[model samples]
Target: MKKIIYLLILTLFYSCTVKYYGYVYDIDKKTPICNVRIKTIDSLNITYSNENGCFEIKLKEKVKELVFEKENYQAHNLRTLSIQSGEFMKELPFGDTIYLISKNSKYSRPKTTLPNNVYKK
Candidate 1:
């Protein structure tokens, strides 16, 4: 009776979903940073952080690498993070707080830094 109800609730809470929530903010101000591009490395799924600097995306089970970029901010690379089977929500913080200042001309960009957030076809 009560045991069955508890199991049902637990199952419902742990069900897998194809959604992810992400956010970007100023390193110093802590204010929401809007218009950050969220590009899926492998697929064509693309999104932008809203004014509140938050975004939600749907993806299959795989490593997801989310890139946070802005015009004036120094581009910060974040490694792909894994999400659990029963848990669909995951948060990825950059190795260090990203401060976007002037651009670096001597920087060499890599073709790919992290694996795509979905399974390979």
Candidate 2:
């Protein structure tokens, strides 16, 4: 009876957690993006991509979504249902790659000279 209870507990614990492995990339450049932050939307669990833009995250299986963020890149929200449904694989022929779009710098502008009188003040 003790063994049966232990097995049941183990199964329950195993079923509650899941691990995901994937890579981050630049959508336009097709290059790996390192140090991208990945976090579960419903949980505090978080991880970051390595130098190779690869990452592994372990979290509760109940997590429904994941958010990916990086500097100068548009944040992406990935639905876990798509992952489970194999939609991710269909999009990428290779391994899982989460592509991020680079954000255009809104402040980028040609340098302008200030008025000579204003500089003297």
lDDT of every model, 2 decimals: 0.63, 0.78
lDDT string for model 1 (4-116, tens) is 99999988766654565666777556778788776677647777778987776566553456566778676665555656787765666533333333343334343556678
CA lDDT of 47 in candidate 1? 77
Model 1 stretches with alpha carbons more than 4 Å out: 1-17, 82-121
Itemize residue pairs with steric clashes in candidate 2: none
Instruction: Report the Cα RMSD per candidate.
Output: 10.9, 9.5
Error of 2 at 111 (Å): 24
1-121 in candidate 2: lDDT tens per residue? Answer: 9999999999999888777779998877789999999998854889999998999888765456689999988788886654646554322132488888887634334448988799574
Question: Model 2 off-target regions past 4 Å?
Answer: 1-15, 82-95, 105-121
TM-score of each: 0.50, 0.63
- Given candidate 2, what's the lDDT at residue 58? 81
In model 1, which range of ten residues has the least summed lDDT?
Answer: 94-103
